[model samples]
Target: MSNPHPLQVERRGSGVPILCLHGHPGSGSAMAVFTEPLSTRYHTLAPDLRGYGQSQVQDPFEMADHIADLEALLDREGIEECLILGWSLGGILAMELALRNPQRYRGLILIGTAARPRGNYPPIPWWEYVNTGIAGLINGVKPGWQWNIDTFGTRSLFRRLLKQHTPTAYHYLAHAGTPAYLRTSRHAHRALNTALRQGYNRLADLPTLTMPCLMVAGADDINITAQSSQETAQTLPRCDWHCFPNTAHLFPWEVPNAMNETIHAWLRQQNL
Candidate 1:
């Protein structure tokens, strides 16, 4: 593959490799909560998928592009065999990668994701988009107010919405306000969802992914319901699933310590 724009990867620690893939509209940095904890024992490689964070995408792209990028990234990194940790959109891509070459991955840590996501995703209020755009414009014009815009402007609104819709996840994102949350390309975001909406169903292929899998879901996640994760887990040959109470789609961040403990225990149990 001729790499047009080489992915920007955040690599940490050293030992067994673990490819960490972040959620939609997120970057490699978003996976820091998971990567940092495991870094002491495992080498974690988190890449900002094309169009997210520093790995900017000029033209509109689809899921295939993302898969290609992951393939190229692994090849370039000399990662012939490794574990995969994927959240939300990353989980979908992880499944695709595993299906494409099941032998490459020894295990999978999937969080807040699904193989065939069903149910209507609640739409973000139109006013939030307008408010965010205004905030972005203000920041663009007066770079000095970047922090103010992030805190008092855009993030303030995000906090309110998350508090109302997902109070548990809100607690983490509200304070952290990670930069990756704002770096995603709108075009890329739209294209990725468009592709998913068009058609994405690999339920039948689940059996092919015979590697040990640890799946975690938020009990209250409407975006991709815990039931969805349960269904996927049932199909997989070796999958240990968990659904955390009082958490939503961003449960990984909401309860990082607990999540890490679960992951570590699962890894030990699988002897990976």
Candidate 2:
């Protein structure tokens, strides 16, 4: 929690608090997809995760390190009550924080989120090495380097990914420090390996969480399979799951209006 580089956070609007959590391969600004729309009614607080965007980088690669940072940030900002919204990896961290300390938040909106990542199962972790090898090749980076972010994407991949996000997404992508997203992706894969080695699993912990939750999933997300989606839905004590038809993991960016309205409605419904 000392001088956390990835914990960079920004406040927006002037109403009920809404904490926006971004995904892996992203900084806090990734919430740019929702802020403009939500800020109209709800105050939005978006933070770059440790080692992602304008946030400070630090030691201890575990996600719990981030939970601590979030708690500290909230305390400092006098944000004692809020609605929690998280996408992708940020979703995982959100659930972890809520489970560990549910009193801090009023409710949750899970986007393309999961209670547990699919790992250490029928398929071995070897795929990570393969993908990292390929991703490294595509990124022209070897592990253990300082992670030059400029090489994060080739022109083709960048163009394709750019097509899926928004101008705000572009703003985040265009930031000079945003290149860290690529390295974070590579590093998260390795971190996932470390989590597996420690014998920790997301599934076994999901049912322990009793917080009120609303989960929104892309029908076509490759990152989180449909089966896992159902599992996440069932694990919660209070949850409403909505599967976005014909959408992928990038649906929030692809359909920002729909995502924004859905989230606003959820918050209003919960009165958070």
lDDT of 2 by residue, 172-262 (tens): 3444214645536544555555765775347777676666788887776666654566678778878887877766566775566787778
Q: Say which candidate scores most in lDDT.
A: 1
Winning candidate number (TM-score): 1
Model 2 quality (TM-score):
0.73
Among residues 3 or more apart in sequence or in different chains, the pairs in candidate 2 whose N, CA or C atoms overlap within 3 Å are 5-55, 5-56, 5-57, 6-49, 6-50, 6-55, 6-56, 28-47, 28-48
* Model 1 C-alpha lDDT per residue in residues 1-272, reported as the tens digit of each score: 23546999999999999999998768888788889999999999999998998898767776688889998899989999999999988998899999999999999999888898754355677776677656545544544353544554444344332212233343345433346667889867787778867977889989988999998988877778889889999899999989888766767766778989999999989887
Task: Give the residue spans of candidate 2 off by over 4 A.
Answer: 1-6, 58-60, 119-193, 196-200
Query: What would you estimate as the lDDT of candidate 1?
Result: 0.79
- Residue 220, model 1: lDDT of 76
